[model samples]
Structures are given as C-alpha cells and as structure tokens.
Target: MPLKQFISGVAEFSANEVLQLDSEYQTYLQPLSGKSLALTLLPIEQTIQLQFTDSRIDILLPNNRADDVGSEIGSEVDSDCHLTIQLSALSQLRDTNQLTTLIKQDKLDIKGDLSVAQHLSALVNGLDLDLTEILTNKIGDVPAHSIMGTASAVVNYVKYVKQHFDITLGEALIEEKQLVASPLALANFSDEVTDTRYWCDRLAARLAILEKKQLAGDK
Candidate 1:
C-alpha cells in the first residue's frame, strides 16, 4: 500500500541520518583529541565509552557493541575510568562549569577515576558554539544583529516587568497584613465592646429610677 511505502521511506531516511554522526562530531574532534573515557549512567545501567585516537573518535555503545571493546576490553577501554553519574545530575547542569562546581562542592558524585572527570570537564569546557556566526551565515549580518538586539531587549523588558511585579506583590502582602487584625487584637476589641454595652445598660437603669422618683414628687 502507499501508506506502507511512505513509512518505509521515513525509516530509510532516519537510517541515513544516523550515518551522518561522523560529520557532526568532526567539528568537536580537536578538543576531544587525546582523551578516552567511559561514562556510565546508573539505574538504567548504560555505558558510553568514548575513545579518541589519531584519526577519529570511536564511541562504544554498551549493549549493542561489546565486540568493539577489542584488546582494550577490560583494560584501557573498560577499566581506565568509569565515571558514574545520575541522569538527573545531567539535566541540572546548565553549563560545563556547573558540573565542576557541583563536583567540588560534593553535591555531584564522581567515582572510579579522577582523570575521567577532568577529561570530561575539559572536553565540555573547550566546546564553543558561536551562534552569531551561524546566524550571520543564514541571514545577512545587519538583519541578524537586529534580531539579536531585539531579542535582548525583549528579555530585558520581561526581567524588568517581573521585578516590578514581585515588588508590587510584596507591598500588597504587607498592606494586607496591616489591614487584617490578629487574633489577640480581635479578642481585646471584643472585650472593650462588651464593657461599653455593660456601662450603657447600667446608665439606662439609673435614669429610669430617677424618672420614677420625679413622677412621685409631682403627684
């Protein structure tokens, strides 16, 4: 059927996309040049071994490619340095420096080898993707610059609005607290009201007695 053919073509296209990994990683080959390290993600228990050589880097996928470990299998590739980290830790890292800081603070755990951690940090830190250059290539320099400037302005405006909003909310909270009576204050107010009512009732009774006495004297 035509629908089946379309699905098959999509699968074939994805297969070709996976083959393009070499070209994509070639740009990063310079910094990751001499470092060979293995990173193991716990819980799911997957190992990603990156071996850098004279020519290109080889990535050993744990379950799928055990044979690639070859002569280095249990020696350099497997036993060199297994950096164990949680998947959650990876998500929390905003940049390369955050990982190193967390590690130094003892918030992030690095076991097996210290060299692995150092190599990983250096490799990540050395990576620099210049979005300005990429944007310039896609669009003209002037237009790209204009777009970036507008984006920066919008971000600054949003931050300004958020800051004002937080200040206004804090002021409103203080005003609300001042307007509302505390339990102790309310109790004191209630006692005063009861005392006023009692005094008023006593005054009324004394006035009635005085009026009766005046009537009797008139008779």
Candidate 2:
C-alpha cells in the first residue's frame, strides 16, 4: 500500500477511536509537554507538524495543513525539548507491519539531535496503545499479522535509538554512547567521508593524466 494512504487510514481510525480512549492514550503524550517534533517522510516527500503540549495534541498532516488532526488528547505537562525525525529510509513505517520489517532489516535511517530522538523513542515505546485491540474494535477486523509481527520490531527500533543515541522518553540519557549526543560529531564524520571520496577521485584523475603523458612521450 502507498504510504500516504496507509497513514491517512491510520489517522482516520485514530481520530475516532483514540478520542474514546483519551485517558489511555494520554500516557503516550506525557513526554511531549512543551516539545515539538518535525517528522519528515522522505519517500512521499511529506512532512507532519507535531506540537506536544500538556493539554492538547496538534498534528498537522499533509492533506490538512491548515487543521490539526488530533488536538484534544492531552493536558499541559512540562515543556523541555524538541525532536526532529527524518524518515529517509523507512517510509514504509506508515504501515505498522512494514515498520517492523524495516527495523529488523536495519533499514531505517533516523538522523537528528540524538537526545531529542531518544526521548521521543522512549515515549513511543512506553505507550500502551494496544493497536491490535484498537484496530479490531474500530475497523471490525484487526490487522493481526501486521500488528503482531511488527510490534517487537518497532520496540527494538526504539530501544536501539535510545541506547545508541543516549536519549529516552523522559528526558533521560543512557550512560553509554553519550558521544553521539553532539549532532556536530555526526556532521563532522559525514564531512570526512565526503572528503575521502573527493580525494580518491582526484588521485584517479592524476593517474589518468600520468598515463596519457607517458603515451604521448612514446609517440
């Protein structure tokens, strides 16, 4: 299924059913107080605007940019940080099942401020949104295969992000991999990699020039 369609369907279902279980879903929003997240879906070239507040949740989807999708879900808690997620690889995450497979394959590429990403992952992992039950009741048929197979994969991704990035949902940083907390470090590494590639090309060009010069001298 296309990512946009899948996300739209999920959003529709979530809007109706999630509101009914407001108290239950509120737990997931606890980490968002005063936080903002920019979620970019690379494949679809779409972005979702999210603002996490203690009392209200505002999700702006591509189709409805002027309106918020889920706005009546939470209460004012505490404002602390911001997170940005570039879903450059796992655009399939729009489907819960595909998200599981991508995570298992280690194909999801998430880059951002490590601390913020980690915290967001933790919040998502801690959510008790029993999607199976919700879908079964809401859609009248649960996507059992997709949900069960992908649940652990999704959880593992969160764990990996938390551990590797040093940030958890509650603003807690894991002790290990703290070095990744600096986004500049990642940028520097990327720059070095790019530089190495440039130098390799330069050497190849130099070798070609020397070979041509030798051929000319022989002539």
Candidate 3:
C-alpha cells in the first residue's frame, strides 16, 4: 500500500473512534465534568480538534479535506490548547500510551493552557493498563495468566531473532567483504613506507662514499 493510504490522516481515524473511546473514558472519569477544554492536535501537517464536555467528546477534522469531514465536529472550532506532534509519534503512543515520555523527549510540543495539556497527557497515560486483568474477568485467572505469558514470550523471541540477525549481517559484511576500514591506519602505513625508503637511500649513499674513500687511501 502507498504511504498515504497506509497512514490515512490521523484526524479521520480519531473522529471515527471518538465515540467509543470517549464512552470508555467517561466511565472512568465520572465526576468533575463540563466542556473541559477545546483541544487542537496538529500531527505535523494535519489538524484535529477535540472538545471535551460532561456529556460527550467532540472531534473536529479539517474542512478542505473531503475525506476527513464526515463527523459533526469536523467544522471549525476554537482551540483551547494547541499541540504539535509528528504522525510517527502518535503511532508510537499506540503501544506505549505514555504521552509524558514523548513530552520529555521533546517529540511533542504544547502551547496555551499548560494545565489542560498536562491533563490531556494524564488522560492518555490512563490508556496503558494490564490486559490480563481485563481478560481474567471473561476467562479464568489461570488461563488469562498463561495466555499473557505466552504472548509476551512470543514477542520477545521474535525481537531476539531479529536483533541477532542484524548483528550477524553487520559483522559478516565488515569482516568478510571488508566494507568498512579505518582511514587513519592506511595513512600511517603510507607514511612509514616513505620514511623507510628515505632512510635506506641515505644509508646506501653513505656506504658508497666510505668504500670510495677506502679505495683512494689504499692507492
């Protein structure tokens, strides 16, 4: 698939899932609710707006892009806090879900309403939870524990093999093909050869002069 097709405008994706995700968030955050804030998210290029209230969360997408303008909040809205982050950063958050980590690394930029931004990061951090705990409710505790352990081991084994292959390929290329070398070592070898030739020429000339002097003295 093309890069654009594969990464189909984050704003559009979020707008579709906003209802479901907001419902889950609301269950957790029952108290202290209102039009909490109007959030503006700029994923490097595309812009998305999120408005939080006691009732529900509204998602706003771009107007120019026909593809992303389907939801009610797709229209223009006032931004309470503006955040700029790369599309790749959002992808990373899918696994880690620690917005503070990105903020610490300077991968995410926030402006306007510092408190609101910090709250948003906390909301995102809440996404990271133990899957085993949720699964145990549906299945038995022992089964859920076994499943998670097996899944984790599989992921680790795949990662280990990938890492081992990368290191092996790099070493093979350097040692067998001689693809990499030190420029300083080559220069040192050249300089030593030149010095040896100069010394040998000087010694040969001195020996010739001594032999000629001895011949003259004998005559």
Give the TM-score of each candidate: 0.42, 0.33, 0.51
Residue 122 of model 2: what lDDT? 59
Q: Compared with the true structure, what per-residue lDDT tens digits does model 2 show for residues 95-211?
A: 445544665666554344444445556554555666667666655554765776688799999999878665453234323545334556668999999999999999999999999
Whole-model Cα lDDT per candidate?
Answer: 0.62, 0.56, 0.62
Residue 201 in model 2: shift from native, Å? 30
Model 1: colliding residue pairs: none
Return whichever of 1 and 2 wins on lDDT.
Answer: 1
What is the lDDT for 87 in model 1?
68
lDDT of 3 by residue, 19-107 (tens): 34433665433331443344334443555655666444555544435456563332444566666675667666444456678889877
Q: Tell me model 1's lDDT, rounded to 2 decimals.
A: 0.62
